[model samples]
Target: MQNNLPTRKIIHVDMDAFYASVAQMDNPELKGKAIAVGGAGARGVISAASYEARMFGVRSAMSGRLAIKLCPELIFVKTNFERYKEISKQIRNIFLDYTDLVEPLSLDEAYLDVTVNKIGMPSATLLAQTIRTRIYNEVGLTASAGISINKFIAKIASDYNKPNGQKTVNPEDVLQFLEELDIKKFYGVGKVTAEKMYQRGIFTGKDLKLKSLDYLNEHFGKSGYFYYQVVRGIHNSEVKPNRIRKSLAAERTFSENLSSEIFMLEKLEQIAEEVSKRLNKNKVAGKTITLKIKYSDFTLQTRSKTIPYFVSEKAIILETAKDLLYQDTLSNSVRLLGISLSNLNTDSKNTKTEEKKVINVQLKFEF
Candidate 1:
C-alpha cells in the first residue's frame, strides 16, 4: 500500500435535505412534517424529501405515487427554483469568504480547498465549524461538513455525521477510516456497482486493497484501477474551481409504460428536441449521442453512437436516437426515455497524469 502521498486540506459541504428544508423554512406548516418537493401527479417524481419523509422510505427520484404509498402523511410541495437559487447564492458567498478554490458539485454541495485559504486558518476542522455556524446563523438552514486530506475522503467524511454535523478525518486516520468504510459508501460506487463488488467478495476497502491491480482491471475494467488506487489512498485530483460540464441530457418518465417502438417514436422526438435545445442554450455540441431506456421494472439500458462531428440540431439528434432505438429488441415495456450528448467541444484537453508510486506530503497540520 502507498503510504507516502500528497496531502491537501479539503472540505466537502453538503446542505441537509436542501429542497425539503427550504420548503419547511419558507412555510411554517411544513416544519417537522414529512414533505417531498415535487408534484403529486401520476407522472410526478420527488425531487427531494425531508428526513421525516425519509423515515417512511420516501426519497428523491422516487415516484410521487410510491412516496404516498410509503407514507400516507407525506405532503407534496411544488419546487421553487428561484428561491433555491437565491439561497444557494447566499451560501456560496459564505464559501467565498474563506476560499476562492470552491468546486460546486451542485447548488447544495461543494468542495472547498483550504490548503491555502484567505483566512490563513491552520485547522480545517475549525474552518468547517465556522462555515457551518455562519450558514445556520445567516441562511437559517443547517449544513454538514467533512474535512480530510483530499476531496475523496472529505466527501465521504461529510456524510458520516449527517444533518447539521461535521466529521474530520486526520491524515493519520485516513487509511483506517477508509478501510473500515462499507464498500457501498465509497463515493462513486452506486447500488449496481456495490452489488457487483459484493458478488466478487469485495465488501470493504480492506478487502479491495488485498486484490492485485491486474486482478481489479480484469474484473472491473477501467473502474477497477480507480478502486485499487483509491483503496491505497492515492487520489491526486485537485480541486478545480472551473469544473466543466461533461454532458447534458433530458428525460421523461411516462405515467404508463409503452410496449411498442411505434408508440415511443413521438416521445423520442420530443426528448431529442429537448436535448438539442439544451445543447444550443449551453452553446455547445457533442459528437456522441446516447439514448437511455428505462424499463417499467426499473432496469436501465443505454445505446450510443459517436459521429465524426459534433451536431446540435434536433433533426440530427432525432435521427441518431431513432437508429439506436431500432438497434435493439424491446427488453420490457419502457417507462422512461432520455437523450444525452457527450464528447462535447467544451471538454477539457488536460489529461490526468499518473501519480508516482510514493510521494511525501506535509500532513502534520491540524485537520
Candidate 2:
C-alpha cells in the first residue's frame, strides 16, 4: 500500500536561534557570547537564546530570572519583530525564486515543495544547499535544510543537523529512518503522549508500526490515524503558499501565581484586549473564543465558547472570555493566562488534489 503513494520533493528550512542569532549577527561584539533575546526584567520571558546560552541550559520561554540563574553572564536583548519580519521576507523571497509553493511556519522556518521548481533543477539536495547558501550570502544568516519525500520527514531531518547543516532522506531510506527514530521525536508526540506510549510498550516507530489501525484509533483518537501512516512514510500533504491565519492568540505568564479569581479576571481582560487587537490588525473576526489556563503545578486546561456571530471587538472578546472562565471551577492557582480567537473568517482555497495527505504536526510545549 505504501508503494502506491506519490512521491514529493520537500525541503524544510529553519534559521538557527533566529532572534538571538540575528542579534549576534548585527553586533560583532556579541558573536560567540552567551546572549538571549527577550525582556530583561524580572518578570520578562526569554524569547530566544543563542547556542552559547543554550549550552548553559537557558532556553526560550524561560523566565528572565531563571535564564540568568542558568547562565549568569547571559546578555538579554529586547525583541525587534520589525527587523525579524524584514529578514523573514528576504529569506522567503529566496524561496520564491526556486518554487512558488513556500509555506512559512513562522519568521524562522518554512516548508518548500520543490518537486517542480522554477530553476528546472532535478536534485532537491543541491537545491536545498543552494537555498541555504543564498540565505547566508544574501541575508547574512545561516539556515539548516532538510530534504525528503514529504514534509514530516523533511521537518525532522532539518533538525538532525543544527546551526549550519543539511540532511536528505532518499525515497528508499524513509521507512528505515522512521523505524529507527524515537517516538518522542515524531513531531506531535508530546511528553505525556510519549509516556503513555512507553507504558504501552510503544517506544519507537517500529513499536508503533506493530499496532493495528484500530488499536491506534482507540488509543489516540483522531490523531491515531495520522501516526499510523506517517510512521510508514506515507505523508502526502502539499506545501500551501499564502496559507490563511487560522487563529490569533495572546498569553502571559505571571511572576507569581494568582490564587484569587479576581486577579485571574483582571489578567484575562488584558489578554483578551491583546487578542482583540491582533484580530483587528489581521482584519479578521472569529466566532470561537478560547481561554487557556496554566496551573502552578504545570497542568494546563482550556475552555472555549462559540458565539453566533463573528466578533473582533475587545468588549465582546473580554465578555466571552470572562463567561468561559467562570464556566468551570478553578482547579488550582494559575501561573499563566491566555486568550485565543479561532474559527476565523479568512478566505482560503483548497489547493491540493484528491489524494491521501498528511498534515505536518508540530507539538508545542509551554512551561
Worst 10 residues of 1 by lDDT: 350-359
What are the models' TM-scores?
A: 0.91, 0.90
Instruction: Give per-residue CA lDDT, model 1, range 1-367, as digits (tens).
Output: 2555778899999999999999999998999999999948887899999999999999999989899999999999999999999999999999999999999999999999998889989999999999999999999999999998888999999999999999998887878988988999999999999999999999999998889999999988999899988887778888888888899999988878999898899999999989999999989999999999999898999999999998999999999999999998988999999999999888864335445343345656777
**Clashing pairs for predicted structure model 2, backbone only:** none
What alpha-carbon RMSD in Å does predicted model 1 have with respect to the real structure?
A: 2.9
Q: In candidate 1, which residue pairs clash?
A: none
* Cα RMSDs, all models: 2.9, 5.6
What does candidate 2's lDDT look like per residue over 200-240, in tens digits? 99989999999999999999999999999999998877788
What TM-score does candidate 2 get on C-alpha atoms?
0.90
